[model samples]
Target: MLHIFCPHCGELRSEEEFHASGQAHIARPLDPAACSDEEWGTYMFYRDNPRGIHHELWDHVAGCRQYFNVTRNTVTYEILETYKIGEKPQVTADGKQTNAPSTVKGQGEKV
Candidate 1:
């Protein structure tokens, strides 16, 4: 079992004490009523399922009962860092910021 360090509790605890929530830092729509059906649907259902580095939200369920962010490697299952919700992650894939969209090489032919 993996031992996770709780930011709030300031102690390392077992995995059973924490609940792995979905992707962290998801921004909720400011005006939900104004959002289109597609936008709202994407907000509710869409999440990043990348292969390498992943940032996740974890709740200290059995300990402090507070939520925090964990930067972990998906392939090796290694926990890189555990931080508070508002804090930015230090480790990133390829040392590049992943917020921007990657460029596609080919263009579609006109029909």
Candidate 2:
């Protein structure tokens, strides 16, 4: 029942319209042959589930069929921003202002 914002469509939609692909912004090993098992395991299992704000990758399964980032409040379920694949997350150019994206209505409660 979560509402996910589609960066491509600029619409908030039900969670059903989206699919969690996995962790986003993962840096792949530049030299896989040089990596140890421990290093690979660390990359695979470690996650930063911070309490206040978090960035995640989500796919607009039913909408744009594209993947985007979402900045949401973990505790309040408030989405701070939803932006295109490579664009900034609604941040000011000077990086001083912080504006959370507004929620669109008629969507389910979760997402």
Candidate 3:
């Protein structure tokens, strides 16, 4: 079982206590009212399902009932680190120090 650290609870808890929402740090359209149908559709439906290091939004459903960000390695199922929603991640696939979300090239292959 994956042990996840809840930034709100400040304790490491089992994965059962949390729920993975989806990819994190997605920017909402500046003007939803002005967005084209295709643009809105893409924004609402499309998400980065990367194979390497991925930033995710998780909720401590059975614990603090708060949401946070998780930087994880999808290939190894490793929990790299967890932070509050507004905070940036410390690790990336590029090996450069950055908080921005890392981008991978392929679909199902490991980076």
Evaluated with TM-score, which candidate comes out highest? 3
The global C-alpha lDDT for each of the candidates, from Candidate 1 onward, is 0.76, 0.66, 0.77
Error of 1 at 18 (Å): 0.5
The true-versus-predicted C-alpha distance at residue 84 of model 3, in Å, is 0.3
Better of 1 and 2 by TM-score: 1
Can you list the residue pairs that collide in candidate 2? 1-110, 2-110, 2-111, 3-110
TM values, all candidates: 0.83, 0.72, 0.84
Summarize candidate 3's per-residue lDDT along 1-111 as a digit string, tens digits.
777878887787778888999999989999999999999999999998888788889999998899988878888887777888787677765424575674321111112
TM-score-wise, the better of 1 and 3 is 3
Q: Which ten residues in a row have the lowest lDDT in candidate 1?
A: 102-111
| Positional deviation of residue 20's Cα in model 2 after best superposition, in angstroms | 2.7
Q: Between candidates 2 and 3, which one is better according to TM-score?
A: 3
Best by lDDT: 3
**Of models 2 and 3, which has the larger lDDT?**
3
In candidate 1, which residue ranges exceed 4 Å CA deviation? 95-111
Which pairs clash in model 3? Answer: none
RMSD to truth, every model: 12.4, 5.4, 7.0
Q: What's the distance in Å from true for residue 104, model 1?
A: 35
Q: Positional deviation of 27 in candidate 1, in angstroms?
A: 0.6
**What value does the lDDT take at residue 60 in candidate 1?**
91
